[model samples]
Target: MADLTGKRIVVGMTGGVAAYKTAELVRRMMDEGATVDVVMTEAATKFITPVTMQALSGRPVFVDPWDPRVPNNMAHIDLSRGADAILVVPASTNFMARVAHGFADDLLATLCVARACPLLMVPAMNREMWGNPATQRNAAQLRADGIVLLGPVDGDQACGEVGSGRMMEPHDVLQELIAFFQPKPLQGVRVLITAGPTAEPIDPVRVLTNVSSGKMGYAIARAAREAGADVTLVSGPTALATPRGVLRIDAHSARDMMSAVMGETPRADVFIAVAAVADWRVAEASAQKIKKTAGEPPTLSFVQNPDILATVAALPGGPYCVGFAAETEHLDQHATEKRQRKGIPLLVGNLAQDALGADDTTLILYDDQGRHPLPRQSKLAAARELIAQVARRLPAGRVPTLAARPAPGSPSAVPSAPPSPLSLP
Candidate 1:
């Protein structure tokens, strides 16, 4: 069955350039067999004409509750009565605050106040407004009230200022709407993921670390959670916020990360190794910050840190382990070799330069089945594909994969879809 077929969605548009996108969103949702009711705020009407929306929806766009032409002037009440969910695209700071306060001055807020269905608000505005404490507080309040805030994507904005606060694209919002109703296929599973670059302390302030920003691992954790898994994310230092429902364990150095993962890995049903662990640490020295000597330079002995992926994969009663191979050159060869050497049933490989810190990546998933190239997509979308692939690889009735014999990353390794993409976005 189509997940969103015949599903009712109420889309709220506010005063922003993004409001124009809502008309397209309405059409797309309809294409997916969704019945969408457009509710436009006064400010929203300034951006997208009610006539245009009405033509696209083939239904009157709800603008005011007290329009005398409408029966009993109850347009707001009737519009939201049977929605499967509500999506507030182009949700402005003003609209957010009103929703946060249960203000019903506008038709959109009135509908939200009266609706019992799931509430999803996609906030779109200037980055500064988005970052303002009051706006953030309102968003927090709305979330706490069971409002699902999708996105105000980051990048260049209509106002010429940039940071965040752009509404999610129509297709993305539509996909989210579809996924919302699908059966949680990976439900009841427990996932443990390690992400970001593990630091190896040298001098007091100096440390060894890579360019990893912990995007992939954390995205996996999020995807697993959305699929109904209990996820524990063991992450190294990074600027990303922890996803909802994920238990985040902070780690600094490779040793710290190893200890944390070792402690949690056993209980997980699936373990994905995505962290770029520092290869070596200072053997000894530096009780305080090392001073730059006026002479030549100082030398420090280095010791290799434990290979976290290899260690975790080898555990007798461990979770089904997955590893990542990030290479600068010969990406496929190295990833395949790492996959075999690490003894993981699955390995996610990608180019470090293109995949390192960017929001988009193309992955080559290596396994007994061979390598499958997953098209470049946002980290969030890639995460979903990876979760689904993991589910398929695992044995039926369990989240563990069936035994597969392979030549170990051999040139003839079975190909599937590309490995999951990770991004700091």
Candidate 2:
């Protein structure tokens, strides 16, 4: 099933150049199985025609407050009555001021005022307008009134100037909408995760690394963030973009990963060791590039790397540890033994062939209760399920202190001091 299956959304557009993005948003929403109803203000219609929105939404666009389409002529009330949420895309500074004061002079504002569902606003305007003292006050008032604001992120704007007050990209907006509907089981929890494959340098010109693509770990990071955890990812080299609302630390080798993980683990409530760390490294890596010989290869000795999970688990009063075991065979035995060996409460296991570099895989959760296998599914879906399992297993009465946790984009939300930068071979 699609993520938003059976969900009903009301997409409200105000006057702004960002209205073009709303067209894509509506199409993407429908692609995710959400039934969308497009609502437009008079100013919005001037920017993007109602016919364009109607074509994208597959429903008759509503722009007039007194349209005869509604049986009772109350489009504002009827349109939003059954909606799960009303999302105002490209909400202009003027519209925000009107809504902030409860003015319902227009159809979209009237629907917002009459809506029973949650209201989410995406502010899009000039940096100066957004930074205006009055606009700031209005924003604060809207927040106080329980309206959710997605973003007016810093970036290039349409007015040939660059600063804050740009609408979030359509994909990002969709992600936020999806997260809004998710269960915040990890609210106020601090999660530390390691992802990708740790590289061991054989020489300046060569490195040994597994085929692990870090998809699962990144997915878990995103899921944890969506579940309201303050997530920090210690990632090895990977081309994937950092998940929204996640702090990322770069790690190249096993030692680099270990250092990063240890530094952040003290403040973490949960530590998920998901990186495919190399067990061994070159005993003595050559300072210069090793040249290829005519017949024989240069001999190299290896030494075992520090066991990151075991070390962290061994720490006194350390975070709750979770380990992953990618086994070529006998996953049940290897996974169970690994969990016991590491002294962690939970272990996730999967077949190496099924999981490495793959987007979908079967996962088995091994705990004191026994092994519970999750159906093969997308990494994100599996990650969400794993987070749910972890939530259930957490100590009772571990109530979320959401207010105490740093809010996203706040200075405190970032790592105060990052680990030393890794110099990759």
CA lDDT of every candidate? 0.78, 0.88
Question: Which pairs in model 2 have colliding backbones?
Answer: none
Residues 281-373, model 1: lDDT tens digits: 889947899888899888889888898889988888677878888898998888888888999899988899989988878888999777888
How many residue pairs clash in model 1? 16
Instruction: Tell me how many clashing residue pairs each candidate has.
Output: 16, 0
Which is the leading candidate under lDDT?
A: 2
**TM-score for each of the candidates:** 0.61, 0.93
Score residue 370 of candidate 1 by CA lDDT: 77
Q: What are the RMSD figures for all models against the true structure?
A: 11.6, 5.9
